[model samples]
Target: MLSPASIVPVILAGGSGTRLWPVSRDSLPKQFQSLHGTNTLYQDTLKRVSDRSLFSAPIVLTHEDFRFFARRQAQDIGIDTTVVLEPTRRDSGPALLAAAMVAQRLAGEGCLVLALAADHVVLDEALFVDACRAAGRAASDGHIVTFGITPTEPSTAYGYIRPGSAAGTSEARKVDAFVEKPDTVTAARYLAEGYLWNSGNFLFPASLLIEEAERFEPAIVAAVREAVELSVEDLGFIRLDAKAFADSPAKSIDYAVMEKTTRAAVVEGKFRWSDIGSWDALRALEPGDAAGNVTHGPVTLLDSTNNYIHTDGPLVATVGVDNLAVVATEDAVLVMPASRSQDVKALVAKLKSDRHNAASEHLKAHRPWGTYQTICRGERFHVKKIVVEPGGRLSLQKHYHRAEHWIVVKGTAEVTLDGRVFEVRENESTYLPLGGVHRLANPGKIPLELIEVQTGSYLGEDDIVRLEDVYNRS
Candidate 1:
């Protein structure tokens, strides 16, 4: 039985997802994108383990830049989530600490936290939930329980877990050791010796985790404690101390605390899970045709075999390709051999060194209100298509240099034009003069779509001045 009194799920939803490039960007990663289905990876994760009667509201830990997107994903999935926005990516230690502090605050000291990564894809949700329940049971005894996926192959990309003697015949066992990703020979030997994959998921009592942190990393413990204790709460999120939390050691939970703790135990998992860490791994999730070709959008193949072709726009036809990945977008087309997919991170590094914005941003970026896609650009003006969710509002803000013209294409828009609020239904337009305060909101039952044309001497995102916001950004 689940300890229903105080069990909160703390999900780590922050990742760069460098390998799954083109689709996954720095701000909008793979976890937030619809990889192969209607729901995103993060949404699937939330839906798999959520049972309102058994689990408390989820506490999500994510990066500061993706806070609005995280909130929107959670709301879309119908999970009442509380977000803990990290000022920077200081690694999983601070991430979990941030969530733990919020978990304790919202639930209590006696709460048990099930820490899960949002980018993981599990084929069998029932078996996965069963494994989590077993771990949750172990956590009730003040033990830090982590699940290990039963390895079906000798894979070098994942770490291994050697399960020791069984803990009284349950699936639980004393974790004999945690090994890093090994070479082919070493991985083969580990598989022969019956080692499991180290899944980065954990279950721990909130107070015990804090206690262990206090003993092992006193500095992190103090900083996180102070950050959470003195934390500001707004709209169900706990913002960590920017300076202190950023100063915390950048380490994974595996290295920071789990490897050193004696209370650590492992529960064998019986679910088919993939981390979606690389394009190769992601390709394995989707089924291919008879010739081993997988295509998302309109695409055709003449001589392509074992190729992963994805197109966000018009038809992408391939010929005489094998074991290759081709992803064509409106702005970019990425082509790589499956074996060389891991090297895309180096390509991203090169792009960053050359000051290319394509390394970090996608064509469409999600926001608290809705979504915006860059349409066209010129020397002095830029055009974008913005969609506002029903009953959604943008921050009351003004641009210092740029003048904006909003042409409503569909639905109704509640416009705040120069401190005067008004509504414009379909096929109407509004204008904001330079140095004017304006905001856009959706008032109808459907999404509000509009074309925003911004023209100015300088049209950077930093030129905005926010006066007030309902989503709590100052």
Candidate 2:
């Protein structure tokens, strides 16, 4: 009997997710949202393919700002994560390349990488894992393998994959051609002719990818090679050289490597899959009531059939809305015909141009140690509800302008004020005067919840000057 092949999963979790707005913001993307079940899509993805012996620790490629969120998700699901943070905003080509480099370093030769998006949901996890193993086997034989999801319906929203020939198996198919997102009529014909939806999932030998990178895009290969060779191990994150990586040309695998290489192959995924790109796509997958309404959070709909109303917190009530998407948040509410759900990005653009904070940021912001939500703010005072996860701690830092008063509501807190360490329990309060270095943490097994009242001349996040942190914040 052969030992199971070593597989490394590389999760790309850097999407803006504009269509699912009001709830999904730049600070908190859709990959982090619990749209369908209790776990976020990324967390679900981790659980789907989690096998400690077969797969190594997951290598996550995401934005610098979302590192903490990604780390927290991995912790929540108990998946040991090796996070790779991108210093600059680039597309999946560079992102995947960076992650592939890290994965190569971890698994070395004869190993396979399973690269996948963070926000996709597979209805059949068993089938998905089976496909992954097959793809890994194919990859070990020096082929770049991709998963071609079986299309359930005509979808113009996703790129279509044209299967060339059967590659020695009933399940594996060679690529005849790759088509970009098509027109409605083209999608209909592809769906009828048994074309598969390009699932954007890949499995490849690390050497194959590295060689292809060097062949087609030599500059990227050099830069990435140098970045990997000189990478600094920072706590848990693998820090690539920012300048070296930023110097590489930005391109996707299709454009940079896969389309130009002869080692490309596709495997038919037996599971049901959805990218959930837009609200229309999401609504179509959501379970609807007898009246055909999919409602989440707090929503009331009257005569609203075949509609989706999603909210984060604010109560939403719809009347006579047929085939529409109604989403409401604390600061924004959007009502659009479900047909035009893709237009939500345009609305977000308008909001951004209008300087609306709702478009770019969330009312609740997550840090490496914890999360803080803005409660109230006046001229010189600001209020916030802060929750520090168990074993999480804030930075030992000083604020130049703001003084903070913390009232613990639940759980235990380890407080460090001006280099003095102390414990603050439930219902206890503490104050940190301005210019005093302080830190907050939950050193217990439960969540640390606190109400923070701030009084300052300039109550801003930039007022913080960090001395030290467990999460490597400077």
Candidate 3:
């Protein structure tokens, strides 16, 4: 049961975070990675709203590729949440509209919805919650409230919000205007003028948001309404209608509603917050050593000052490097000046144009069941290490161009070959011929690990024909 006074938290988790290159990718973005601490940014956001007395079960909006990752992260923190799957990336406007519709349906028109991004880091949790509460009061009065961070630096990276007169007896103020990312000089002037950094978080009444969005962008509201209306449940996920959602204009909420709505209000947020927009921003958040060097994962620095070095594989040793960032992964390495961290997006764009897989995907790919990492690949064959969690099952499918040989390395695997199910223990092996329908499942209490060798004319993922799927992958 949910309390009537509880605010509905709508967490947007859909961005690809391209600037944080080698570590963050479309396959697993920065929100899903543990960049700062043990918990991912998404999990940290979930923890902020875990107080059931103040917040209801959150409504998470994510894309199809990250649906399981979002759900699994919620389950990791024991949070009961509603995961809404966006059929396509339609930016924050339609996504929020759809979430507002869901909130209205669940909690009624008067319910307050706290819209937050899943990839932000707030150092002061209590101050953040207090700010949300203050914003909630303004939102309850039918004002669309956006949290504005007190600018600590003249950062040209974030948009600015000019605060106007007070809304009421509360600390909320009318939003005078919203400004785009400015030049360094303009940012300094804005900071001196007491402008707030638009934190990209909002609190609004469900009915108010719907009304404002409908007034400003009726087409978006119409398309998203249809998308939510025709949404279907797939493996416990509410999947918005693809065609309807794709029709909605791809615009941020700031451009679509916040900038145009007359009832926009700003609440001053005193908490320490960062979007972690790039590696430089990330380095700013992390505490450095005596030499002003932030190092992680087997990194040794000699005569390196004001540098950030991180590696997931191999030792990253830097000598006589100043103001540099060297990040390494199993498949890719990025070495650049710390000041040029913003240019990583341009590098990613070039990589994408060049058809490089490392631009958008990591070596390890996460699936609904578990994860698989490509060890090596050749023209006609590829080797992969697949790990299946306990009670996890893959789809019953067959490939048209590939045959697989699975060597069990750990735990037990329940293999089904053309409806004949059998258990293959550790160190055991099984072979599936091309065009043979098969399924792999972990029936044991521990994770099942296997080395899969594929020999085929084609090794692409699209060659699969799913006969039946528990996760509805087709």
Predicted structure with the largest lDDT when compared to the true one? 3
lDDT of each: 0.83, 0.84, 0.92
> 1-474, model 1: which lDDT tens digit per residue?
465635688878889897777778896888888885789888887887688766787878888777877888788767778888787887888778778877877887788898999888999888987887788777876678888998878888899888888655355788889999999999999989989999888888988887887778888877777777676766766677787776687878888788888878899899998998888887888889999888888997897799988888868988788999888877778888878877888988888899887888887877778889999988899899999998899999988789999999999899887668898877888889998888888878999999999999988878988899888775
TM values, all candidates = 0.93, 0.92, 0.98
Q: Please, what are the lDDT tens digits per residue for candidate 2 over residues 393-473? A: 888899989898999999988999877999998999999999998888888998899999999899988888989877777
lDDT of 3 at 467: 87
Colliding pairs, model 2: none
Candidate 2's C-alpha runs over 4 A off are 1-3, 52-54, 168-170, 411-431, 443-445
Error of 2 at 436 (Å): 3.3
Best by TM-score: 3
- Per-residue accuracy of model 3 over 158-200 as CA lDDT, tens digit each: 9999999999767799999999999999999999999999999
| Arranged by lDDT, best first | 3, 2, 1
- How many pairs in model 3 have backbone atoms within 3 A of each other, for residues 3 or more apart or on separate chains, i.e. clashes? 0
Could you tell me the lDDT of residue 256 within candidate 1? 79
The ten-residue window of minimal lDDT in model 3 covers 1-10
